[model samples]
Target: MTYLYPQIIFSKLFGACLLASLMLLAPLTAQAEYGDVVLNNRAEQSGMRPVIFPHWFHRIRFKCKVCHTEVGFEMRAGANDILMADIIDGKLCGKCHNNKIAWGPQNCHLCHSGLPGLKTGIRGGDSTGGPGKW
Candidate 1:
């Protein structure tokens, strides 16, 4: 019974440590700091979460012109009508996500990871798909 005190202290310390860790990491887990652009034009209708586009992530890898100029994505948030078929046909995202440059659309959850509440909220786009109304 003498060792009981030490066990209690250990348990309290462990719990406190875990709580602190969660407090620090909760926001991070909620969403990455990519300044997401939630495109839910047809996602909700199709029974899926909006496409949280990691704008900052790609901006670091490629130049703006690569997508805006070459890919034809407008500067506006909900500008282009990005569809899954267009991607599969090697047009928009399919150009890179074709398994050669990046992983293909086999994994849906990667992009369809529910609307990330960043500074940019769930501002949806057009019916074809962009960033307009949800």
Candidate 2:
């Protein structure tokens, strides 16, 4: 009976330790899996949800220089203060997101996809900055 008690206690402790480790790892995993940049500098005031820019999706078709260099986009978040007026003027994302090249900026909800149940379709948990596995 005494041996059984110690075994039971040890098993419970091991289970608790495993649970704690998993909980701590969850956030890191989520962050890596979804390397989405939430562009919300002017979204709320403009009466829209934040734009969730999924880097993985873009990287699949375009090189880094295409947008960061050719498009004059800053390498940091919120650095490009993009506005609807600028977009209509054929600037920033309008360079490609236009109806002729990609989807037009008129489809506002497509980029401003930060609603309550927005899903970015990103997967995996390795974020070493290499070609991210989706």
Candidate 3:
């Protein structure tokens, strides 16, 4: 039993080391898989979490034109310079996010989903589908 004790201790220590290595690398893997969008342009500056746009969810419902063309949303993140006033005045997201169509802008967290309290695993699609295309 004395000889077995040393082997058991070594095995336990090796398992712990392996676990620590995996833990350190876990975040990097997640970032690669979820490198969808992290719109932090004005979010952190304005003392808010960056908007994590979920292109996957939106594309599933509305065609790209509904936003990129009609709504005039830029393909890149933070390019629009969206402001709270614009939304309230029915300019940017307010166009559709109004209570009648979708959730109202009053629901701040809906669009300002960059809030730290939330976990945004949302991903977006590339420029594949467009008007008269798909």
Candidate 4:
């Protein structure tokens, strides 16, 4: 009976450990969506530049419909028909960046600036001079 008691306890402990291991492994299989929206259709047509917009960080603060519906952004990138001139005239980004809601067009480095260290695969963060400081 003494030997049987030890074996039973060992089996219970092993089962518990196995369950915990499986639970920890489950999250590894979960899908993580990292934003990658391309901008600049003219660039694609002219073969000059390809703007990659990261939506994950923006989505954290703002809603999708704010830009999609209110700001007149289309579901897909390059479909919004956004122009730098329009923004300068208080259009899409200008709507919020008009010095009233968000940082105005005077701060051109905010959006016009692309993510640096692309070779290192480093995206948005405070370390990269992004809005992550706030």
For every candidate structure, what is the RMSD over all alpha carbons to the true structure, in angstroms? 14.3, 8.5, 11.9, 12.6
Question: What is the lDDT of every predicted structure here?
Answer: 0.69, 0.74, 0.65, 0.59
Q: Can you rank all candidates by TM-score, best first?
A: 2, 1, 3, 4
> What tens-digit string does per-residue lDDT give for candidate 3 at 1-134?
35568789999999989877865654444532233555665666777766776666677789989999998888755567777788788987888888878888777665566646543233333322222112
Candidate 1 off by > 4 Å: 1-34, 116-134
**Candidate 1 on 1-134: residue-level lDDT in tens?**
45568789999999989877755654444434535677776666677777888777898899989988888777776666778898889998888888888788877888888753333243322222212222
For each candidate in turn, the TM-score is 0.60, 0.65, 0.58, 0.49
lDDT of 4 at 15: 90
Question: Which candidate leads in TM-score?
Answer: 2
Give Cα distance to truth, residue 94, candidate 4, Å.
1.2
lDDT of 2 by residue, 16-78 (tens): 898778666754756433557767778777788778888888899899999999999988666
Cα RMSD for predicted model 2: 8.5
The C-alpha local distance difference test score for the whole of candidate 2 amounts to: 0.74
> What's the number of clashes in each of the models?
6, 0, 0, 0
Off by over 4 Å in 2: 1-33, 116-134
How well does candidate 4 match the true structure in TM-score terms?
0.49
Of the two candidates 1 and 3, the one with more favorable lDDT, higher being better, is 1
